[model samples]
Target: MVDVEFRVVSDRRDGLLLALGQTVIAAGFTLLRQRMVNSEEGVVLTMVVRGPENGLLLLEERLGTHHLVNSFEASPVDASVANAVSAPAAAAPAPAPAARSNGGAPKPASDDAATAMDTRRVEALLPQLARDYPNIFIQLLALEHDLPPAQREATLRYVGQRVGTWVYKRDFSLGGHLALADAVRHIALPAMRQLVQAELQDDTLRIKNSPFCHRGEHGSSCHFLRGMLGGLLGGPHGTEGLRVVESHCRNTGAEACCFEFHA
Candidate 1:
């Protein structure tokens, strides 16, 4: 399924949201899902595609008529989403750096807010999941850190069955130790997003549902959540006019843990 995504760069995202709701409803397009995020850039709209090419065309046409979207750009669904059904979305491309017309730096608060949310976005989504399947969620994190390689693989191979369509991304390349982050991209995330939308999700972080949550017990044997959890854990860019981020945060670096299903 193709997703129509809109990202608003201006401070007045409320205007963007208004324009979006009107356009989608007037056009009779299904509002499959939407998330208003406080991103590193600014307020963002992560919208799931729920209609056809014609629906998108009509929606775009309507948005063009609105002053709110005059400067905002609408891009195709995430390349990765398409690749899931067809071809792999091309390897990630280098996004252009944010620049100032006067060739100076951006204000501190906005930049810091954006940089900080890179890691927090994942956490923001977690509360809802914790509320619903407290057992499953807690069990997963139980095995998050400090596990032997072979054992970690065995855990994921088992958890993947319960969670469904998961992906493994590792960041051990930089450090000498081996690590794994397994995410239930297709299964767990979609369900979670639905719960979030309905305001029905939970906020627990313990994995009481699965026994795997108790791997070394002292050390979280559960990297299933840790597998794809690497991206939000690294250093940031240090160029002039750039924002400073925590040393371990990879949000500004190329060392992303992974992007899987957000259920």
Candidate 2:
């Protein structure tokens, strides 16, 4: 068993960085302990993780890929914890089709396909594309010029909702009968696989970790997700009035990215 430890101290608090830390845990590493010690210099975070031989490589890759921190140093630690790294990944439950809560639309064909697109692949390529060609998001943002500030935000949110609807319709071929809560908790997150881990309680859906928009560090991003949630609950045949509001964002310095859905 190999234990690798690394620490990061940012001059300012960054939720994206914290989210990356949580990502290490979500990625199936065994977290031994963590703490934030205050000092005259700044905020210091010391985290210890236990894993197999590739632990350091994985950590470095994750941190470097996301550009979360400027620098980090890792060293081997005594393996005191037993079998922590070998723990199996948690399996997400399948989302069952049900009657639409709002009775909005008709049902569609919902079945498992022999060939399914690998979401992890898509997730990886997207960020790389964004990094390689920053103009992608720039072009998306350029559309905001046509509308006023509030209207621009609202429009983008609506666009995101439509994108969610498209995913449910074309990508998943899901029926309108899926319950919003179940859709988010099961279908959406599971389909996303390692991209994110979340908890949905009532109308609030909290993301513990996500690689999207560089974990929301993209700043003024995830408009599509905001819209996606809206469409997921209220699209087409669904009558449930749903709104998604991200309360905490890694881009803005919160440990987790939270999306609150309310009628």
Candidate 3:
């Protein structure tokens, strides 16, 4: 195994860390330490990772091609420093306290705050999801089982938004601005078909055999699809403030999952 230090610069910081981290893992490396800072150039990310010596080339290729990365440099770490950092720690650290406000008071948490999606975990599995396509119900089943019942719907929705935004930025952002119906037909429908069987009819989109709720046993499991639609259709470059509603779901004994769009 070899240890390497990487410095990456990006135009934005919104999901820079998560995106780069996903690329690193996909290229077969384990992240050891990381730091981020904003500079005149942009968002700078410095990370140390360990992986097979032969993996460097593949890692470089992945980093260079990543959509979120503007430029990056990677170099082998000095043996002594790598060993020192890799050594077992003397003791475990104490748990971190809640963050404080500028006034030094603990801030109360808001239930309305959107649940944080585990982008690293979700992105890592995205390739597998795409590769397997419509036959990916086993993976969706695992995700359904893993999440807590109370937060499952919200988490799936958030994941959908993340995935949808990612797809839009990666695929459709370069084109001219389109109207809602055009965007839905040209952008959203194609994107949706990548994961499920979907067809847009008028203002309604019907999804046949959605992997998330195909079994007809779970109670309305189309939260992710609904959230994805919101992300795809409501972005600034697309149509803003568009709403997606799940009118019918196979999980509720409907033949297909139906979504209605409203501006």
Better of 1 and 2 by lDDT: 2
Superposed by TM-score, candidate 2 places the C-alpha of residue 51 at a distance from the truth, in angstroms, of: 45
lDDT, candidate 3, 162-253, per-residue tens: 55666677678888888888888998899898777799878789998676664334677788788778777775666667778899998888
Reference-based TM-score of each model = 0.27, 0.38, 0.52
| Candidate order (TM-score) | 3, 2, 1
Candidate 2, lDDT over the whole model = 0.49
Candidate 1 lDDT, 1-263, residue by residue in tens = 34666554444564455346545655644443445666666666644444566677777776666655434467777646633532212342211123333645322123433343222323222332233232233223322322344445434322322232111111122332221112223222433343122111132212222223323333333334333222222112111231111121122222222232222
Task: Give the candidates in order of lDDT, highest first.
Answer: 3, 2, 1
Q: How well does candidate 3 match the true structure in TM-score terms? A: 0.52
Task: Give one clash count per candidate, in the order shown.
Answer: 35, 7, 0
lDDT for residue 233 in candidate 2, whole number 0-100: 57
Error of 2 at 152 (Å): 4.0
TM-score of model 1 vs. true structure = 0.27
RMSD of each: 20.0, 14.8, 13.9
Worst 10 residues of 2 by lDDT: 106-115
Q: For residues 1-263, what per-residue lDDT tens digits would candidate 2 score against the true structure?
A: 57777776555554533465555654546454445565565666666766567565766687555544555667776664433432322331212232343654222212221022222322332332233221123223333332344444444554444444644554456554666666666555543332346666565666755444443224544564565566555645443666567877766667777787555
Q: Each model's C-alpha lDDT? A: 0.36, 0.49, 0.69
